[model samples]
Target: MENKLNDQKISSTIETEVLVVGAGNAGMMAAAAAAEKGAQVMIIEKEDSINLLRLGLAGVGTNAQKRAGMTIDKYELVEYLAAFAQHNVDEGLIYHWANNSAEAVNWVEDNILKPHGAHLRAEPDSLVTSSAYQGFSTENDPTIDDETFVSYGTWFQEKIAALGVNLSFKMALVKIIKEGNVAVAAIVKNISSGELIKINVSKGIILCTGGYSANEELLKKWNPLALKKNVYNDSPRNNGAGIVSALDIGAIKDEEPAECIFDRGLVPVGKKTEEMYVQTATYEDWLWLGSHPLLKVNLRGERFANESVPYQFTVNAASKQPGYLYAMIWDDNFDEYAKQFHTLGCARVGFPGYMANAKKLREDTQRYVDKGLVVQADSIEELAEKLQLPAENLKKTVLRNNELVKMNIDKDFGKEAYRLTPINKKPYYGCILGGRILCTSDGLRVNKKMEVLDANYEPIHNLYAAGNDSGGFFFGSYPDRVPGLAASHAQTFGRLAGQSAAK
Candidate 1:
């Protein structure tokens, strides 16, 4: 592929006022916004159809929120977001999203959702928002090619196409043509015919091609230390093509790449399967273990950081472990843990069994032990033996943990009293806990207007980046508590990029 790049001949050429790449949430939003501004918008999507898994989006102040009588302090929310990123995030960008997202949400609802009898489902919590289609039958719509088609993307594409925006499918971005430091055009490939087409941009090019989570090479280079463990990348299509093309034209990169890390079940080796592995021993073993307050210990049978902290911090501690796996140990008095406070208490994201039925959680635990996903022992020593850790170390750690339980204080890790669960009862159990990056948060550095910037902090002429392709939105780690941040960024920044590029 590299050798043929120099001799490659362009098959055809097209011109557009705004060229939007990738047809995911951000890309479609960008194209619609540009077209609404009367720009000749052309969207090139690599997939046969777009909006594969966009269930819903996030927004702060919207018609849905207003109807629900919900209000979030924009100032406090911005401060919370900045502090969540440890002040490594862009405050201007946060404020921009907080202020502008309501309009975008209302636009999407009014244009695509309301007509279909669907609406934005705003949870009682301000952060948790979703676009719920109440089983609205689309079988009557003639434009729906698939009989089973029911997604925000499908509705959004139809709406945009009606607005005179050209939607081209099976077209992949191969390269970007730059004049000096300005992005002038892009080289796109037709996946079916193996034909390359040049798209000249008269206004600007907005790259919503997503992040480098799907590219292993880019992951090893940028997010190596943080994501050393095996990852379960959710977006298999986001291969960093946009970031690479931007960098090839001297687009500045973000200072550090952030990862969307969360505690998940044991990932299978040698094959990529979306199978959900449920951990039985502790809270982290189950999927989306961020909200679960469980006691975790490293390979040396030593409690490291506060387990109740952010999920990314826990995953970071696991990366520092010997094999990038930690143990969540508990005792046979599992009924003591049967209280729904930690597991089923909080109404956060839920898996199949535990959150639904606590009794089913124990049943699943035993089943996993039978399946060898969890280790069960008649004693702590035996559990240690099975885990391949020093027996004395395990015993000592359990002893210290019991002492902490009695005192209602975690002297070493500074764990809260309510979270100090002692592993004292017979039939001790343990399960390995670890998680992988769902996506990357670092890419081409962009300003508040979503304009791709150069090293000198000047916007690259006619070049913009939205969604994960843009940077300065996140740093250090992805906060699980924030809920709808990623979807919100895509909506807010994608619209911002479109408006700016149209101007």
Candidate 2:
């Protein structure tokens, strides 16, 4: 392991008009778009294969645009995100995405993504969206890669390669080459052969390398109050080197924690969210969606938000909890309900991506009691004692829930209207659903023009950022919907970065 600025043993140098640092959806789109503009493009990916990560992709609102046989204009998508995130993002870069959204998303779906198999876009359960706003449906939308945000990354790479764009894999970026506040190129390492590689860019280096939720040290440094537990469904390649490089070059991070990533999580979460973890009571993430299919909640127990609306908190219900990973208590009937939901698409199935089989789902949840992944008791008082919640509060909560079950409305948690249900069975299940983080919402701060900004909010020239690289772009929180948010930014800001670099 020779670690030095220059290692004479290794030799590799390549130059291109534009060098894209990542091959995720945004990186791919940026590379493809740049290549289309007749720039010589090189895409750098650390993964041995493109799109080999556990990203969760849920394409909702855009399907309507596809159904009408019209590309959803970039502006409309921008409108969706801005309003959804309470206008917390960068307008200029988002507006640029508004222009590129349709073209980029449409192209990825129509051309590259493989469909029809275990990985196809199945219709949402009628129960899930029954109470949702009419605007949420994305009909006739093609099934995507079913990974996380980079679902479209693989397709984008193939198209770029076809156009003769050079793609380098297993390359880890250590830092950027800057001079006079301008980044001219990057210093990289060939992770496999112990080689140092330099990639020079004549146009500019587009860093789609992603955010820093993977780095516990960085997370604690940026936002000390937020938790540092990781329950990733992705690979280690996205360790946030791009952001670190930006920071070393005078990038400032907004104070918000990365959105949708884990504060802590349960091993059974793999049943719903796809990322598994060992059972632990300390694994707590607020407002995360899980794979339990049906969540069991009580007085002290109430569903935090609409389970049906995956990423809906941003669309029609923005005021709710940010992550939504609270606990749900259930009994035998609920189990039957989940079973029935599987038989047909009647109930809101939890893991549209990584659903645990019914038996496994039951077992994973059951082990939590002994392992403390969940609190259990034969009686309500015992359950409350086990949960460490206020006993009176717990009892009253269950009573109130039983009473409310008749009304079929949860005034407290805004549970979607449905048949009244009660959790009154013995051997009750009390599983703590922890939130899982996605990308860091807080990144090296940048201005609205997609320029990487300094601590004083001044632009760093010959330097630009897009995708998850733009921290202040989203409000201090990560929204429920992952795809459309970054997809919009990556395409729009990425394009803007490319065009600005070319200029």
Candidate 3:
């Protein structure tokens, strides 16, 4: 890591001690931490707000300060977190976050989001209600940030701004300046005006530019077995500018790829009903985590994986499907069972519809049928006819499934014995679940100091990476019941990257 005074002459240039790309949760945290440390922090973002992530109340953020009593997280609990993060996480970063994530939450509470009457209640019986919020239990995985703070990421961003850090929106990073293997500056582009901007960082360039989940081509590159791109609406331009820029500068990424949380329900993107996505993925994990023993199937209606497997595996399998869609047909009995298992906050109903909702929920699934997507009918023959599938094959498949269910075998699919049921519903609803892949878990390898690594295992000097951009922990599916794994990692690595860059 070479350290020298670098002043590259450009037509328009801005200097800063720490330059953070992609002002999402992690990047915002990085900017705030660096700025609070008295670094001239400049954050470059692509969205009007921090829209690259889905931030809700879930995680030990700065808000916990007001909590009269907050339980201290134990090392055993962090061990579960490590397991949930699939153990590729930096122990130092995890220690930083595990010790101070609640502190960050407390800071947010004291400085940012004033409490809006949100309370952290005990997670109910997951057997009855499928919730992966298992705290400190090795039986569960924790990817979801099930904290009690109201919009932690947004509030934290606001706090960063309050710290007098320079915040620029609609500014996307296009390049990273490597002065003979040492990062020094970055090239940015204003999306509105097509103006190329150069940002010269005298201190360092901390690439917090997020992950490449929104990039289908990058997704394919990361995980060749990945089927198709399937993330619910995020900034579609999140084509991994940070990771790609690093790659262009010869950053050899970590080998074990972590799969992004794939959301593949045909639904409207975010709160916008005006737009409809035919194939997407969001919160589909809840379905797999539910008590419904329904075996998933490809567009060909064949049994896929054990329902209890990690949602990422199911997501990966779905991506590998040729049609990139599946029909999850279950009986009305298991349907009723799942209905009885809704969480505490939400009313005991499966979504606003059955299990999940898409853009055209409760609409006739015939269009899906026309596209060889889904089929619904009273009799198996009618279902086959309507779906243009082999009627005899469909009947045999159902019969075999029923026989396996009766015998508790599941020899073909290896489905979990619990909650097993045969699909014998008359008015079967055939919804299309497209197998859209998020960026695979493969990320830019980084060290404990959050420095990007080369193939020779040397940390690239003056360059730091955070968030999904720094991979190597996730190999396959994320664990269950232990939410907060991703968000904590984001906070942990982001802050670590900032600290490293500031130093």
Candidate 4:
């Protein structure tokens, strides 16, 4: 098929049965699945190499779950996830994930992880649930050293390459060529050479370019509230190129704006939210101790919402606070308190059977203290002074929090008793907290088959979207309670889309 490009020169043309864009978690899975189905697959990644940062995969009834004596009702999980979005999500997509996530996870284990030295381990169940949101223990993380987590990405790349998929880096998808309403080819640009190449796709084009978390303009347009407080932590390449291309070709997107924001974005003592953008700090800068349900006070030195809620809820509350920032105040016994908090998902790194690296938590906290990002004082008044808060208000808040700790009850915010650790142990520490955006949770609409849908809710022929590039699963906020739900959704639907498109 010869497609004319206005004011653009094509340096070369390649033919493939499936063209997968953005070689992240979803694109890799899609390419591998298409190759497994005996289809010629070509993957183009804008980056020089694949992203190595790994997230746990949520699954139900998987072999790992069986071995760990963990049983989850997939239907109940589907309902909980839907309710998490206030029924604004596509429950069918959530059901699709619940049904096939096990297969997808096991596929990774059998083909990519287990064959190598790595294996999947389930996250520990929550110690207690007092809130309406219930978190499941279905998150599975690869057994690898945190420093060498890149090995998992390497193994996946090797596995897919062995399946005869052509993977190229530094090639970014510019646009999808469509004839009528059917996608036929794609125009990609070589980032290093600035040369445009056309790939004729006979089967389909799978967009896995992630979401617009890093796109400030899109964030301001769709999720202005989230943008007002969040520090972008995702890859900058996620600029909605895939979604924009699909939209240009008549694909519809989710109406409600959503984001996967987490708590613990460390804001410097006097830094404003506007000064925060792409977080360039190392992992040591992450306020891991802040993930614990510390006594959070606004700049006015007043206690706010229940700090024991989900990570994003803390940020949501902070968004309404003065300057969209809050301070997490704790004592020297944060290590013990963190364990008592029993935080779920990625924040569960201190526990066993997951990423058991508690030492890093302490080290990170100390690093922040050394850098002055976190203030350390021996007294409540002194700590309040260092944090630039009203000393009397902070002292009263701490006294009240201590009383709650003594009573084993949070009368004000109804925080779970177990997570209500006292901040009166002496040598008080405080760090200003903000929101760190992981990704946008809304994008191009897709059905269970991972087919991109048009305005009339009909499939855009031969066009597929998976991962953050596609939506209809989430609205308003990310369901972190599900634990690795986003990654699992990406892997599962990416495979499904690749299989459907290859057919």
Per-model TM-score versus the true fold:
0.81, 0.72, 0.74, 0.95
Error of 2 at 229 (Å): 8.0
Best-performing candidate as measured by lDDT: 4
Across 265-363, the per-residue lDDT of candidate 3 in tens digits comes to 442112121232222333332233222335556556566666544445565566566554444665435445454333222211332123242222223
After TM-score superposition, the amount by which residue 115's alpha carbon in candidate 2 deviates from its true location, in angstroms, is: 11
Off by over 4 Å in 3: 1-9, 56-100, 115-154, 228-235, 261-263, 266-293, 318-325, 332-335, 340-375, 403-418, 438-440
Per-residue lDDT value at 241 in model 1? 90
C-alpha lDDT of residue 200 in model 1: 89
TM-score, predicted candidate 4 vs. hidden true structure: 0.95
Candidate 1: where are CA atoms >4 Å away? Answer: 1-8, 49-56, 125-151, 265-291, 331-371, 422-428
Candidates, ranked, lDDT: 4, 1, 3, 2
Q: Write the per-residue lDDT of candidate 2 for residues 1-503, one digit (tens) a residue.
A: 22244534338777777887887655766677777678888888887766424232223334435444443334554576677667766566456544544455455455565432222342343223343322322222234443322244445556778877888898888787776777777778888987778777777877778776556566668754333233442324446788888888787766655454432254342143323322222233322224333443322444444444443232112123333334455665654555443322111234342333455455545555657666666887776666544567667767877766678776665655453457778777565444445566566676655678877788777667777776766765544333334444555566666666655
In angstroms, the error of model 1 at 108 is 3.2
Q: Report the C-alpha lDDT of model 1 over 1-503, residue by residue, as the tens digit.
A: 54246226878789999999988778888998998889999999887877534443456677766766766667776776687678887788888887887787778778887787666655443222111101110001111221222356667878998989998999999888877767889999999999889898999999998888777678778877644553455567788999998888788878787877666554422122223322221233344333355667777877777776656678787777776767778877664554533432122323211233455456756766776756888888898877766789888988888998899887887765676677877788876666656668887888887889888889899999988898887887875454456767886788889988898
Q: Which candidate has the top score in TM-score?
A: 4
| Cα shift from native, residue 250, model 3 (Å) | 3.8
Instruction: Candidate 4: give the clashing pairs.
Output: none
